[model samples]
Target: MLPDADAVSRAAADLIGSAVRAGATTLGVATGSSPLGTYAELGRRVAAGGLSLAGCDAYLLDEYVGLGADHPQAYRCVIRRELVRRTDLGDGHVHGPHGDADDLDAEARRFEEEVRRARIGVQVLGIGSNGHLGFNEPGSPLDSLTRVVELTERTRADNARFFDRPEDVPRRVLTQGLGTILRAERLVLLALGERKADALAAALTGPVNPDCPASVLQCHPDVHVLADPGAARGLLDSPRRR
Candidate 1:
């Protein structure tokens, strides 16, 4: 486990940089607090001429449904502000499911086709305190594909911090499901803070079940987990409480 969040971010960045240098063309990126440091490090590397993501195609892991284009909390807007604007990846190279679509099911199909065409090389993820990856909350099917899902109250509550009020958070989302995310050549799951400790432990060592959706990563051939001490406490048997 890493000493702190910064170290975990650097480790994740180093791996991503190596992947890019080795000619990985597609990247799947995650939003939220977990990946902020990693994206910042990537932006710094680009600014220093040490790295470039110019031609890399970026796919967002998920998006909230019904948010307007100008909504600050919209996943697409968040991605542009947090990563794309800070790096060499052009806006055209970044894609996310159309959460505002008139027909959500058709949008999900279109997103699946787009991702299938691009073939994601590496996917970055964050384990929810409820053991979710992307928006695949508890009880999501193991073989689920890109689809729209009702947001669990727990998931909505956790995300409330990003909005002005708890009720302002969207009630549904379009997310790359367990099956779709598993198609990536590699997975990097990042977790930080004591709040994520229990989930991280379940994802790393518990049964590969839909109840703890992230646990399915155990079956993946190439999965990298980067967590700070606080988040790793459960696995390490530390005295830190979650």
Candidate 2:
């Protein structure tokens, strides 16, 4: 486990930098408190001219349904403000499923196609308190594709801090599915705080099942989990690694 979230961020930066230097142009990224530090570090490197995302493309992991692109709490807006604007990627290079689309199913299919064409080289993710990856909450199909999902109360409650009121949080979201996330050549999952301890342990050591969506990562060939001590506390034995 990492000393803290900052260390995790630095480690993630090194990994991402290696990928970028190795000519990986397509990236899949997540938005949330967990990724904020990582994005900040990457942004700093880009600003210092130590790195560049000039022609690289990024796809967001998910977006809350009913929230417009410009909505302050919208995942798209959050990603743009937190990462894309701070890096060299153009407005058009970073894409997200249209949460406000009239035909959400069609939009999901279209987004699935877009990612398939891009062939993501690296995917960064954050697990939910309920062991979810993206918005694929408990009971989500293991082979589900990009699609709409009803947000769990736990998730909505966790995200409520971003809105003025708990009721203001969207009830649904469009997210890349476990199967879709597994398509990436590499995967990095981050978790921090004691709040995530149980979920982190379950995700890494529990059975691979739809009941705990993040557990599906166990099936991936190249999955890296970065966690702080508090988040790794639930593991039976040693969870930390160099």
Clashes of each: 0, 1
lDDT of 2 by residue, 61-104 (tens): 99999989999989889988998889997878889899999999
Q: What is the lDDT of every predicted structure here?
A: 0.92, 0.90
- The whole-model C-alpha lDDT of candidate 2 against the native structure comes to 0.90
lDDT of 1 at 139: 95
* RMSD values, in order shown: 2.5, 2.3
lDDT: worst 10-residue window of model 2: 233-242
Candidate 2 segments exceeding 4 Å error: 236-242
lDDT of 2 at 217: 90
lDDT string, candidate 1, 184-204, tens digits: 999999999999999988877
